[model samples]
Target: MTLNTKKDPRVAVIKTGTTYPDIKSRFGDFEAWFIRALSGNLDITVVDVAAGETPDAPGNWDGIVVTGSPAMVSDRESWSEATADWLAQAVAECVPLLGVCYGHQLLAHAFGGEVGYHPDGRETGTKQVERLAASDLDPLFANLPRTFPAQLTHRQSVLRLPPEAVLLARSAFEPHQAFRIGQCAWGVQFHPEFTEAIMGAYLDVQSPELTREGLDIDRLKAELAPAPEASGLLQQFSDLVLQMKKD
Candidate 1:
């Protein structure tokens, strides 16, 4: 049965980079993950910026989601920089947006926040994320428990939040785990679309580096558990988009 019979809200997924070839073969690409994570509820379109696809006009889509990337925001790639400018314009227009992982860092940089290598280093594996008190009142995050677990793998983080950004969540390793800008834009440092298999695949590929960093690879793998609550955030965000279309 169709979950949304009314005209579904249109959402664009800005593909920043492709997934690891092995991972892509297994789970499709970033856009596939997002579509599945949201349970195919919204009318989704994909814009692969890495391949030179331009984002849809601001008036075209009801909302946008920026996918995580292997490239660092600090690298200042031309395409990446251009996407940031577009995001700034989208925010100015009050378009609902969700940025994940590298997308999260890029959102911060686009709005005057600092992004760089974490002071301590990479944060990989499933970890607890604490929703800040401010999240309690957020239209999307409200009523969520104070803490939840999510899959994460990143060497860079948002070291400083953007001006006027409302912080929404945090973890011991990532202080700016989540934040909101304007009334409808959000950035999450964790991967709400990542499944346990994907998380394990990441850990497997980074085993050498993780071991060298004094992280227990086996323990990290052992601690892996499903983060259903974390994945639900995507559904909530999509619902917010639907609500926005109504108003």
Candidate 2:
């Protein structure tokens, strides 16, 4: 429940949206997934920013994580915009931050980058993501392999990264799969928190729409596998936060 009194990093997880009813019943919501992935070493708090929950100032926390959402960043809803503003401040304060999916797009938007629906449409299921040469210099991604499988399900994406953002990784369909701003802020388009089962459930729930969109559901389901490397990023982030707090 706690780490060393002064050493434990206080982390706030900003929940942007809820998962499907079935998914929530089976695997819990977006925040739960992130908590599980991040593990329990760090002190973590969930803030439902989508529901008007305002979190403490970014400086109060040692680290911050923005969870993926069913909501689209392109809509720029009042709450989403407000959260973006808060994230901007978090970035300014140099908080150790990781934004996933919707969070990724929101971060880019907050930094004046462009976010919109992918021209090629939604990218779903497990896919191979390749790290760019720039990742070798990135603290969070430096040790990762050149290519790895990662879970993904997104319609909107960070079509353009912030001027100062460094491209970290990319998939065949998504050029902005992962990027980092400054030293501590990161945004990943892939769902590092998603397990194989969760990815399968997502495909099942979106089967009708996928079919209508001309995707082969069976093929996607069959390709589901554990993405250990991708999932491990959460723990790596926890380690980074803890180390930062110690300093």
Q: How many Å off is the CA of 144 in candidate 2? A: 0.8
Q: Specify the highest-TM-score model's number.
A: 2
Off by over 4 Å in 1: 1-8
Which tens-of-lDDT digit does each residue in 47-122 have in candidate 1?
8887888977776778889999999999999999999999989999999999999889989999999999999998
Q: How accurate is candidate 2 locally (lDDT)?
A: 0.92
lDDT of 2 at 216: 93
lDDT of 2 by residue, 59-81 (tens): 99999999999899999899999
lDDT of 1 at 30: 88
> Which residue pairs overlap in candidate 1's backbone?
none
Candidate 2 is scored at a TM of 0.96
Q: Which 10 consecutive residues of model 2 have the lowest summed lDDT?
A: 1-10
Error of 2 at 175 (Å): 0.6
TM-score of each: 0.95, 0.96
CA lDDT, candidate 2, residue 203: 98
CA lDDT of every candidate? 0.89, 0.92
